[model samples]
Every structure is written in C-alpha cells, then in structure tokens.
Target: MVVYAISIYCSITNDDSNLLVHEYMPNGSLWDRLHTYKKAEMDWNVQYKIAMGAAKGLEYLHHGCDRPVIHQDVKSSNILLDEEMKPKIAEFGLAKIMQTNKVTNSSHVIAGTYS
Candidate 1:
C-alpha cells in the first residue's frame, strides 16, 4: 500500500480550498465490488486474500509503526483494491496518532461510519 503523494495545491483566495493527489487504484474499493456484484462473482480465495491483506494492513498500523496510528474509519468501503486486486487501506481523515508508550488515547468525540 504505497502512496505516492504527487502534489498539494491550495487556493490563495480560499484557505478552505485544498487538494491532494495520489496514485490511482484501478479496481476501486472492496465494498463497491461486493455490493455491486453477487458474492459468487468473487471467488472464495480472492475474498480470503482481500480479508488477510486488510488485516495485515491494520496490524501494521497498530503494531508495526514507530508511532501507532489508529485508523478510526476502518470499514469495507475504506478498503481499496489495487490493479492486482490487493487490498489497500484508504481514508485516514479520522486517524489518530497515539503516543508510542500508550496503548490507547481518550477522545471527547466519536468518529467513523456506523455501517
């Protein structure tokens, strides 16, 4: 799940207006494919692979990083598929960077999708 951040642009007139660019994923998201097509459309092996990949990504974020990053919005829709059908976690807008020595962080507000 390598992200190549090409560039960032911001409007001088509007501080709120900003844009970020990254590499494109051809296969879209796992949620889209699962919802758009029948379960039979995707073989069991492929499904298992996707699931494992997502789990590994989450594992790395939680345990592998120098500073643990909590992906606050982990869901089917946020799991993107690359051209090879490999799972890539996306959407870190709600991610929380926890202290290295702390196992958890207290938050006043709740975030992420219910579904």
Candidate 2:
C-alpha cells in the first residue's frame, strides 16, 4: 500500500507531464474574511452552491475514489476562497486512506500534536 501522501504542491512527477497546477488563491481564507469584516455578504444562493460543491467534493474523495479518503481534520480555516469566492479545501498533509474492509475511525495512530 502507498505509505503516505504529500501536499499537492510537493507531489513529485517523474515522467507525467499532464500534472495540473492550481493557482494560489488571492482572496485569503473564509475565516479571515469573517473575522475582518463586520457584515459579510454571502447570498443564500451562493451559500447553497458552496455547500453543495463542498459536499460533492468531499463525497468524491470519500466514496468515488478507489480508496476511501478520511479528511483527518476539517474546519473553516482549512477552507480557502478564490477571487470569485469559490471555496476550495486545502491542506491534505494529514489525510489518510481507508481500506474497503478495515475498520475506520479507530487506530493506534496519534493525531495533531505531541503530548
């Protein structure tokens, strides 16, 4: 099995030239905007679409992929926004793969910080 996965930015390419590189978002994260702005303006329709997009993306990772994906950590700060305000989930360094038969959400693995 593949031991670990790296950040999208650092994943190596040996012979594949079809790698896709997404641009660094310029609008910062949703958390930052929420904290800095007094009255934010996210319309209901826009919010619905964002929620749907996030759900679909997460669903794709967890179910659509050959191996199940567990987003070890998910929070508002992890969600980034582009200039057009599209939410993009980032920081998959701690993400783990779940086998089809093995038990999930249970392990001897330690997460986050040193104790």
Candidate 3:
C-alpha cells in the first residue's frame, strides 16, 4: 500500500535493540511539510491524494490484515511522505494487534501524545 512504509531491512543489535530501515522518504513527514516548510503549498489534488492514501492504509491495517492492528497514535507526525509526496504511516510504537481469541479489545491505559 502507498501509505505503508516498506521496510528494506530489519536487524537486532547486540543490545537487543531492533533496527528497521524503511524506504527513503525524501518529502519527510506530513507535520514537517505543513509546518517546517512554508515555501511549498500543496495543491488541492495533492492534498486529496495524501488523504485518500492515508485512509486506505488505515483501512488495510484495521481490516485487510490477518489480525486487525490498532494504531493508538495517529497524528500528522506519524504520516511520512516519499519523494512523490505519497503519504506513508510510520511509528508503530503504540500500535496493538487484536488478539485472535478476543472478540473485543480495550485498553485502560492511555497512550500517545495529544494530537
């Protein structure tokens, strides 16, 4: 999917830290594009494309996969963009996958920063 970051390589370090190298995202995150850079104003078409791509990615995570993945943290900073400005969802530190045996999933602990 256009909105999902494709991991190029993954490895575990001696200290047990996981390393993941994803496809190069030249455009940076949506937050950076919207705030950090002011010279470039995204056209309506480009904005729509990013929106649709992000929606499709979320749809895939929630339904298309074998197990539903809940992205607890969803914000502008988590949406990265490639060279073509295609949005890709990133940073899954707070994500949770629904258990196969559980019909419903709930978390009492609050997670993620303020959006």
Give candidate 3's TM-score. 0.81
Per-residue CA lDDT of candidate 1, range 1-115, in tens? 4421111233243566644454577788888888885455679888988888888888888887789878888888888887777887877768888889776456677789855
Q: List the residue pairs that clash in candidate 1.
A: none
Please identify which of the two predictions, 2 or 3, would achieve the higher lDDT against the true structure: 3
Which regions of candidate 2 fall more than 4 Å away from where they truly are? 1-22, 101-115
CA lDDT of every candidate: 0.73, 0.61, 0.77
Model 1 lDDT, full chain set: 0.73
Candidate closest to the true structure, highest TM-score: 3
lDDT of 2 at 59: 74
- Alpha-carbon shift of residue 45 in model 1 (angstroms): 0.6
Off by over 4 Å in 1: 1-14, 38-40, 105-109
* Per-residue lDDT over 15-111 for candidate 2, one digit per residue giving the tens place of the 0 to 100 score: 7554535557676655675677621667776667556656665776787778888776655566666666676766565788888787666668765
